[model samples]
Target: MAQQATPVRTARLGRTLGQEPTAVSGAVLLLPGGQEVSGRRPSSLLANASVRALGRRLARAGRGEGLAAHVVHYRYRGWNGGDAHLARDATWAVEEVLRRYGDVPVCLAGLDMGGRAALRAGGHEAVNSVVAIAPWLPEDDVAASPEPVKQLAGRQVLIVHGTNDARTDPELSFRFAERAKKANREVCRFEVHADGHGLRQYRDEVTALAADFMMGTLFGRAFARPVRDALAAPPPLGLRMPLAAGFGASLSW
Candidate 1:
């Protein structure tokens, strides 16, 4: 008889930066984007470099307030459809945060497919907020299933997308935000004008906005006026709020 093959175990890892994990009051788990379908190859370091940089920036910005940041290194390099591997890895990261930091609140921040994963994993008890940047959403089709919004009911959710993002449809994210807002009034979205999926044009502004939201949600810092206004406003106004220039400089943080 031929010997049976044994499954290989892949470990999902997280790189923690800024403030000692044990001493931090809050945490943020950063997830990076990946392909739609691929095998169990380890996530690429080059692909996750931007997210790691962002994590460092966030850690530095929030260091005064005892915030620690982590970048999740996924076991796989793709979404893989119904397997939802990335989402599950994000949840695992949240659980890991809880294990290391006790009861501190956590924010899930992701780009592209990671953004979708962050939103999908927002329901974890330790996660208090979610930030999705240029999240990849599926087009409406006979077999396509809508993303779940019920898990986001009690979480503060923010979705930021570039109007000119050719890679991921901004309209799809807007529609997802609409459904999510109906389920949870705290949900809102911001549009980066003339930007692309990378959001490189207004990187500082985007980073500032994310920092502001995370601080507000995790440390009780008051949100900037535009953020507060967007959260309070209804429908198109809130969901389609434009990210203004010099917005990052305007913040007091």
Candidate 2:
């Protein structure tokens, strides 16, 4: 007889980035964007205005859908340029959630570099869905080498990017979504009109979209036709993405 693989237990440890927990069967793990070397996990973890905005919306929506929401503070400070440290942190967060909540389903939402980590880690058995908001990509890169595009197989994935994003190319996100579609039938791409890399204009809408996607996928919460149609819409013409305003000042990472 074939033997079943042993389940490895991860140590439960890390800072809670936001919001109180609830007795729900589902959980959402939110990751904020920042670099590794800045030594600013405190500020970068959940202080970003956009990340907090998303977290608030997710919490509200998750409450309605009976999914507990939590954010993670990385034990380490950086991504290490696509290294495993941040991904390891994410794995730890999921395991902790499972330990506390007892095998509940999980969804991940991340911005920029955090989005990259989520995409790389989304294929894990614990993650039911992933929403990548304006994830960063190396310049002119293909999906095969470092993008982890294929790892999203067998998962529902959503990639939301602004047409005017200057920090990361929206086309790369679109291509990553296409590659993910080859293995996962439930892949979606959303384009925000006239927004920048920070999604400055429609932060609330983006958060709602993520919440809707998470609720729809994990809890059978059906999205309105307008929501579905907008997610499937083509990229609209928009303003150029100006450089972000005072990144370290506003976010401290």
Reference-based lDDT, each prediction: 0.88, 0.68
lDDT of 1 at 78: 84
lDDT per residue (tens digit) for residues 188-223 in model 1: 899999999999999999988998899899999999
Model 2: lDDT of residue 209: 67
TM-score of each: 0.94, 0.77
Weakest lDDT window of 10 consecutive positions for candidate 2:
244-253
lDDT of 2 at 221: 73
RMSD of each: 1.9, 9.0
- Summarize candidate 2's per-residue lDDT along 1-253 as a digit string, tens digits: 9999966533233333344555667888877676744533446434455666676777776664466776666755567764556677777788888888788888888888778778887877889899889997554445536466667777777788888888888887776666666666667777776789988677656766677778877887775454455334443211112223221122111
